[model samples]
Target: MADRILTEEEKAAQERRGAAGGAQRGGPPHMRLGQPTEKSQNFGPSARRLLGLMAPDKVLVWAAMAFALVSVALTALGPKILGRATDLIFSGLFSKQIPANVTQEQAVEGMRAQGETKLADMLAAMEHIRPGQGVDFTAVRNVLLLALALYAVSSLLSWTQARIIVRVVNTAVYRLRRDVQAKLGRLPLSYFDSQPRGELLSRVTNDIDNIAQSLQQTLSQLLTSALTVIAMLAMMFYVSPLLAIIALVTIPISIGITAFIGKRSQVKFVQQWKSTGEVNSIVEESFTGHELVKVFGRRDEVGARFQAVNEELRDATFGAQFISGLIMPMMMFVGNLNYVIIAVVGGLRVASGSMSIGDVQAFIQYSRQFTQPLTQVASMANLMQSGVASAERVFEVLDAPEQTPDPAHPETLVDPHGRVSFEDVSFSYTPDRPLIEHLNLCVEPGQTVAIVGPTGAGKTTLVNLIMRFYEVDGGRITLDGKDITDLTRDNLRSQIGMVLQDTWLFGGTIRDNIAYGRPDASEEDILEAARATYVDRFVHSLPEGYDTVLDSEAGNISAGEKQLLTIARAFISDPALLILDEATSSVDTRTELLVQQAMANLRQDRTSFVIAHRLSTIRDADLILVMEDGRIVEQGSHAELLERGGAFARLYAAQFAGALTEDAEAGQGAVPRGVPVH
Candidate 1:
């Protein structure tokens, strides 16, 4: 057999064709919208899972169930009481029998006469009825009292059930939020590199909220509606099976209509959710880069892009809602159909003396009771579908594979002596594109190692390897005498500190930011660390000193100040290994000097890896590694590399050639005739 391919419209047309064919074949006509799927129809699994969340509050669950049961019982009883009253009125009117072979006109006149006589008797009875009239008023009073009691009790129980449902839902939502946050915290850094910040936020905030809404409203309503329907059906059958049969004929029809609408709504809802995420991403991008857009004179362009996403979101939402909205009207139409059928069929049965008028009336009431719950259950399908979609997205993150952890029996580096070595290590961010290859180097404890290279020369990759931010593909790296992989991530990272080219500061007081690396550090220690980084002068200049509140992302602070604060944070930790990647790149010369001084203080007992473009900064390094294309092309101290006249020497000449020319123009002494500028 060959496979068949169909476009979306073709598939829809095929469904309609199939539905028409099925109807022609004498099968039940299939509805086009709100159709339930195999996955959606089974509430057992989701219900059981939700029930487990409420297990801790067993008493509350029991109480809610008890109230719900009482409510259903009372609701069922109301119809029975009304049915009995109807039966009593008919029986009293027809106490005197009529002839079996009566003309239709004569039968109608007899019924009318009986009805007027019954009304007169009822009025006469009411005249004698009075409040505090003892037993005379007891029967009427009892009926009235029972009706009021049923209403009051059902309403109260419904309220109690509502409270319990809210409690369960709220607690479940809280736990789910916590679980998502914990998963995000544990996720590898690389996972974030591939995902957008806005998308992640949408999952956490919007998707989770959708799930919570379903739990709060939809799930409870479905369960209660199901229970009410079952109770109503059981009563209908007990009262009059034939009428119950007529009433139940509407069930399949109602379900068919709902199932059709629900199916269409589910697809729309998924599209709607996706559109919402896109809109969120666009909004987040626009707001975060508002200044960039203005500077680049692209504000209108950005606004247009945002508007496009916003309009897409609106269209998707409207489509989903339009599809879902069909459910209620379809339900009402089916319900009315059932009513008409029950009225016509039941009236014929009454006329033929096969069923009582009371039973017919009761069946009609039961029909409404039945369809009402079915309608509710159908309506809640959208919410349930939304929750399923959200759960899939959330679980996509939760179930993401994590990086392997260190072996349990692996070697430990106690009080790391700061000796580091890279042994022919090769690595690539992706398999096809190698970033670093067959590299070998060693750094001694307390030595400042300067790594110089052109852009994309693996300088940052080297620092990343030392920190074990990525695992090497082919060889090994060692800290002291132990393989870097042997140490736990926490233990290994605690021994290192870094100040990157782009400084990141979280919202907090200046004192808090400084002490971030050492949370338990005292106020004095925090202040001292800040002073060592030359951040204290800035802090004192502010009206609030160290207590000044930093807004989100440290927006209130300048870039240089942010860099200094990050330096202060790294200083407070006092790690054995330090990596500074263009740490002073953003600062002015004055701020650079303060950072250099801070760096000096921080490097006292630490091994440091410094990547610098400003060649003057690396002049005093114990060793300099010049890299290109993922390999070390030259390695030596500043003077010896200059003597080698290779990659490093050429890089040095290029950097200083202009300065040398300027010096010559100023009549400064040139390099000695025999001395090598290299």
Candidate 2:
């Protein structure tokens, strides 16, 4: 039969047994309830720290900025060149002796009068005129060539700037991902236990990618647009300050609109990211527990729950993007209005002869060039804000406090003789309630110590304390006269080996799993360890023997075989202290016997602690301690405990009463009702 799942009543009964045992060991209540749905809102410090990571690449960044300036300068210069050419053409056309508008006969008469006047003036000053005084085509050609050169240079500079921006952004993203991964690795195990794996994965993958994308767009567009606008505006004012002022009126209005939309968009984008994490967490949990859902026939319900989260994410993202999208169009609208105003005013100025037609044309062109980049800058605000949000998420993990290492001057433990002792050890999961209270216990090396009690009797807590998974609240646990707290955690744990009931195997071949505990172990040593744990039989039964690859978590293997493999792993460690908590509970009677025999061989010279629910397994233990609550209620040999007729005797009787009666009926030797098996 499968081992019974511990009920609340059974757990309480075991606690009572530990209490009656007079030596108590306790622990925090197990947390079986689902975690609550809440999100954190701590992005300020994380943002600051993320910005600091960019300090090293400032030089290349500045160089990119310089190229951007040159590109903008040339872009603005293009319109001024057209304006100058327009002025030259307009001057030549308007200088003729003709009215702004006239009939054909009047235009002909005017042209004939102007030609006669021009010929008379030429006759009067013909001697003063020289051949070299005609138009200079060379100078005109030089100016056109300069304009072409400027266009080419601007295109090259813009391309180089884009390349540099992309390079910098990608490099920064690479470093950020690396730092985030490293930080996750250093975080305490408790943090992982408390947080959802999907949430963490989302932060590393989705959030970082968002930041990278935003950085890519924001970096290139924002820098290029800002520089272009500045250069364009300068040229605009140089052509006609009045027209430039008229167009400049749009700047403040555009800024105000952008700022308002950007602020609201940032809030929505944060919500979007939070919703994404929630959806990811739900999906991850559903996929991981697909078997459970299938067994319970709740696939539709699960799908509905996932759909709810997915819809929430979709709504949030749409809201954020929609709001951010408004900035560009609004800026463009204001820009077009300013463009009309500049054109009207400049046209009047040119008509009144206050400015040349070329100046009006150039001013209009410069206004358009300036407004285009301004609109681009306004649009990029959303990308910049999104990147900032991602940076905040990434930095959150990087800034979290790491697990503190032991002090530099830790006391060394030498030649530990495995005399385990807990002196006044106390602990709690929460400050309000204590789990263990002034607990004490002692066991010598080479002793077979059996810890018996109901579920949650603090049996596992006691072992966790020895391994330093957590530090004691108010006392010390010593091994061989050395305080465990004084030794490095790694050093303390290195001396112990454990085999838990839940065996986990990474995806690999059978030989890899067996050799994990001692990577350098020879084939003979691995075989010996496997033999000691009787793992060889199951391993050899596989079609490919040791070369067979196990499924993820070793799901392809039987529970009993997996348990045996774990035992083989611990046996290979050859630790001074060994712990077996429900180690053989999953196996059948025959497999249990084999495992028990192998365990007996492996524990011959080591200090072993066995926690068994089956009374028969601990019947031959050198010392059996019955626990109630968190204390030992009885301690003695199996026979001595039976003679006491206490908790141990009652437990033994409950497990094997039918067998004892059968033996009695068969006329074989049988002990009394309260007598323990020996």
Best-performing candidate as measured by lDDT:
2
lDDT over C-alpha atoms for residue 475 of model 1:
91
- Candidate 2 on 1-678: residue-level lDDT in tens? 011123223346435633542111123333211122233244345445555666678888889999999888887788677666655444333324334354334543554577754333322221212222333345446667777889999999999999998888888889888988778655644344445667678889998998888878777887888887888878877877888788888888987998888878877777787678777876887788789989999899778877887887798789888999999999889988998898889767654546766678878888888888778877776776666776666666776667656768888765666789989988765577566788878999889899888766676667767777656788899988888877887777777877877677889998888888778889998999998888888877789998889988688888888888877877887778888787788778887888788888878888888888887788778898887766778899888898888898888877777888899899996766556665
Over 4 Å off, model 2 = 1-48, 85-145, 354-362, 412-417, 601-604, 620-629, 632-639, 648-678
Error (Å) of candidate 1 at residue 140 is 3.6
Question: What's the alpha carbon RMSD for model 1?
Answer: 11.4
Alpha-carbon deviation at 58 in model 1, angstroms: 7.0
Worst 10 residues of 2 by lDDT: 123-132
Give the CA lDDT, 0 to 100, for residue 449 in model 2: 92
Report the alpha-carbon TM-score of model 1 versus the true structure: 0.83
- Each model's TM-score, in the order given? 0.83, 0.79
